[model samples]
Target: MTRVLLLGGTTEAGRMARALADAGVDAVYSYAGRTEAPVAQPLPVRVGGFGGVAGLVAYLRAEGISHVIDATHPFAAQMSRNAVEGCAAAGVALIALEREPWQAGEGDRWTHVPDLAGAVAALGEAPRWVFLAIGRQNLSAFAGAPQHHYLLRLVDPPTDPLPLPRAEAVIARGPFDVAGDRALLKDHRIEVIVAKNAGGAGAEAKLVAARELGLPVVLIDRPLVPERRVARTLGEVMAWLDG
Candidate 1:
């Protein structure tokens, strides 16, 4: 039996786990436990960090994991790096199941930034209504400029300790429709859209809505992971395993 360690917390991760099970590989789905209401998957699950790369190496060694599949969110750079290094240290094969990043079309308005701090600065000093889809962890950077009213979306309801003071939470999941996204932007009177290029149809409707509304978007670039063999979809991964 192949002991596969799947690092996931994203939608693609769950799908990948299902694919692995269907391929007859014994899989362990691992998460960092950031969200309250996590996405459901077919495999057995583990949560919490591994105390960095050293701890992860220990886990890989003890569990006799043959493969490490990185199906984490694109913004999850640090964990991805840690996994790459840890798996190398433990002599395990690593494959990144990464979705392709979104591209801008002719009518698309985009401002690319290196990181979230730069993203906030690029927004300028105006108190414009903003739709922030940068996830909960990076919200602290926006606290410095709280003059803007933010419409925040998350899977779980944020606790009282959120960074932005004038922010309203919308508890929901996606694949959001273009119509719903347009309505959201219209209802919130959003002037700007801040997002990471987490590709796929799940949150892609927002990009189309932003384009239609002529809203300028501050896009945070996806972090670079170590160069490795990448499978764009679960089908490609299973093919790799078969060969």
Candidate 2:
């Protein structure tokens, strides 16, 4: 049986969905339902979590899913960890499709941090204009560092009042270009960008824009995940599936 369960929330997942659908592979795409409007996948798609590792294992057994491809965002460590545990319990083959992490290059001003809390600590006591790009879930942590004025870029607007007193939200999606990001940073007077090292073209323009503006970035490293079979590209993941 070649039935596959693809846990997806990134550009890599979208690409894999297309590849799987084009090849007429028996697969199901799943989203954690964090986004208000998720991009439609070609295969049958499911929304919401599988509860946890136990729920995931139950779903795998019920669906008879033989292989699992974890194409989630690099920051989605919890779900990835659950996938590793659930798949192992189910005796199903599993592989991760992780994008390469971003590196600081020449002309780039970066302050590397291990996590979101570390990024917040790096903001210092000065009330600088900050562009916090890490998504809505982690925004609460920034409340501790109330000195900085933050510009948050998110897919959907937050229904509740934001945690920070000096924060503003810009509702938008990406595949953003350098020109637009440059304009955004300048218009907002963003002194620094706080972002995760989520490697992919879709959200990478901000880094380029930051480099061009000579703005320092508080780069949060991806969380360590359980070791698993990994692939960097959609083709490689597909090959692993075919094999």
Candidate 3:
């Protein structure tokens, strides 16, 4: 009778879905529907939000969801907060699957900023060739630092032209390799990198390549979400469900 609702979007969420389905757990995956074509999940999937906290509570009750797992992107603080509130109201067990943040290693040139505004300010007034790898959603912040020339690597081509005065975008999917990333930086004549601290192997090669090229990175910190039970690994999440 342990039916579950999984708030999913990240790569880790896909892993958890496979594990849950293989274990024969009755669960449904909820997607925010941001991506045009998301990777298919192993579990039954629902697209879009649950309206908000009120709609989420109704869905949980109607579906008889006994547990809630927040496996959204690290920056998706709003969804995480809604899940915490909705699950608590429904009196269901809730757990968050959060990835560990990336740490600075030896030979790394990094400028750690608390938020997007901080990242923008770190770029300074003087023009520099920059790689903006933080995704399209937050690219607007760079409007504040127009002096820098930005090279954007994105999943899909932007319908509208970039907001920046001097910027270009390359459309491609990730699971990026260090060698390719190195060449990209070199080709772009990149002077610095601006990235969100989205710690995962799939999108981590840029950081590795930056270190190899001795490029300075402006890393935006993850936003704080509502406090809740959190599991760092898929095994830990499984244990929480069994507990």
Candidate 4:
């Protein structure tokens, strides 16, 4: 009787999907259709957006979705917000499966910025070799500070020219290792790194590499969303579903 919708994208979302499938939960996984080749999920998959809050509410009611587990990326504030509003309107239970944000540690040279614009302003006027580790979506924002050479690592190669004038892209996927990231930073003579505070071990290697190389990092804080129930672990999520 419990039909569930798993709003997914992150590595944690994949794990949650597997857990739901293993438990034989009646669930459907939804992708925002950003990635060209998304990781195959065990549950029935739906690509693209739910239009907006109204469309999402309609879908939930039409599909009889009793619960929604939002496991989207921390930076995906809009989609997360839509989920919150839609679930509330549909009178369905909603919970977020989110990882804690990464914290600066001893020996880590980090400059925390409230948003993308702040991160860009933090770069200053000097043109330094920067590792723009924030992914491909917001690459254009850095074009404002085009003096710096940017090193980008992306899951897919860009079909069009990058917005930045002095930027190069490395086509690869992660759970990247620290040694490789360290070598990459050294090879590029990177002076700084700009990254989203998307926590978890998969993307933490770059931060570790930066710390080891004594390079500064411009860390963008996660966007705030409407408050909702959140579960941090697989066990916790499953318990929430069971309860």
* Better-scoring candidate (TM-score), 2 or 3: 2
The TM-score that candidate 1 achieves is: 0.97
The lDDT values for all models are 0.89, 0.94, 0.91, 0.95
What would the per-residue lDDT of candidate 1 be over residues 66-149, giving only the tens digit for each residue? 888999998898999998899889998888899899999988999999888888898889898999998788899999999999
lDDT of 4 by residue, 114-186 (tens): 9999999999999999999998999998889999999999998998999999999999888999999999999
Q: If the candidates were sorted by their lDDT against the true structure, best first, what order would they fall in? A: 4, 2, 3, 1
TM-score of each: 0.97, 0.99, 0.96, 0.99
Indicate the residue-level lDDT of 147 in model 4: 97
Ranking by TM-score: 4, 2, 1, 3
How far residue 146's Cα lies from its native spot in candidate 1, in Å, is 1.5
lDDT agreement of model 3 with the native: 0.91
Question: Per-residue lDDT for 1-243 in model 2, tens only?
Answer: 699999998888999999999999999999999998999889999999998999999999999999999999999999999999999999999999999899889999999999888998999998999999999999999999998999999999899999999999999988899999999999999999999999888999999999999999999999999999999988898899889
Evaluated against the true structure, the overall lDDT of model 4 is 0.95
Evaluate residue 217 in candidate 3 and report its C-alpha lDDT on the 0 to 100 scale.
95
In terms of TM-score, which candidate is stronger, 1 or 4? Answer: 4
